[model samples]
Target: MIFSNHVLLRESLHAVLSTELDVTSVGGDDGEALTAAHKIRPDVIVVDLDGPGRHGLRTVRLLVAELPECAVVALTGRHTPHALRQALAAGARGFASREQPPAELVDLIRRVGRGERMIHPGTALATLAAMNNPLSARERDVLRLAARGMPSAAIAAELFLSEGTIRNYLSSVVRKLNCRNRLEAARLAEEAGWI
Candidate 1:
């Protein structure tokens, strides 16, 4: 079963996967899907992570806690490391981008049902690159503020660090990331999923 809030996405997905022998049931909306799953006891449940704010994540957590036998897939449009991390952390066995070819979703669901973790290919790479960067806590805070287009003086004031200390941190961040300029360093940090 696939739980989606969007009527069109739910309807289209239902139409595409209804004939598949592996998919026993498909529905639109979380409440209805959960009800149907309880009634039918399907092997897996695919939920749209893009649903309401923390609702999708909370739903996944609840489902995994309540239905240990059922697997959950997080389907979303955003492939950023933050989103993927949140989904996986919330107990989604699979994460697929809505931008991916529809066929990929079927393959992901099947693979995930068999106990494999599915995520955007680049998501792992970017996440790994981010994890490998090893920025210090202060450096990371400075970089985050810099990425938001904050000036050194403002960062220093906000963080209660000396202006010179903030400048040194920015310089160190640039050197660590091997970027020639502050903007370049910020862009690299953001692209590398550091922020």
Candidate 2:
């Protein structure tokens, strides 16, 4: 099973999977994918994790929660350590970047379908390095709100915190993650599996 939002990538991926002579490509987003899953209950779902519209992490979470037997493999263009962690935390069984060769991707899909967990070798070390760098529960809440691109004042209003307090929390998150900017901090949090 494959769930993707882009036509070109979907077609290309389908072509790659079809070469196996057994794998079928059922591609779409959260709703369509869920419908297909309900009907076919595929053993594995290869999901594209690019672009902004699709909440890849949330999709993976839903799939894992709804279809416990199904395995998810995330395919991404930006295989940052943060995104890697988010996918895994959302119950992804495999993670591969678009930069990887097609042959390796096919192999990963097959392996994941057989109940194996896979990660891009390049990201493995960064992921390991991030293991002990967990954000506190409050920090996680702040970050989640920040992910929506909310301003400090808005986040403060929603979370019932002062603007200065929100800024303090954001600063703390950046320091803890060793990130120079809030964006980088958020990315690290995502990669570290905090989201």
TM-score of every model? 0.72, 0.68
Best by lDDT: 2
The TM-score of candidate 2 is 0.68
Pairs with steric clashes in candidate 1: none
Give candidate 2 regions above 4 Å deviation. 129-195
Query: Model 2 Cα displacement at 185 (Å)?
Result: 7.0
lDDT of 2 at 132: 71
Q: Write the per-residue lDDT of candidate 2 for residues 86-129, one digit (tens) a residue.
A: 78989999998878887888888889889899998778877777
Residue-pair clash count for candidate 2: 3
Displacement of residue 87 (Cα, Å) in model 1 is 1.0
Which pairs clash in model 2? Answer: 81-191, 82-190, 82-191
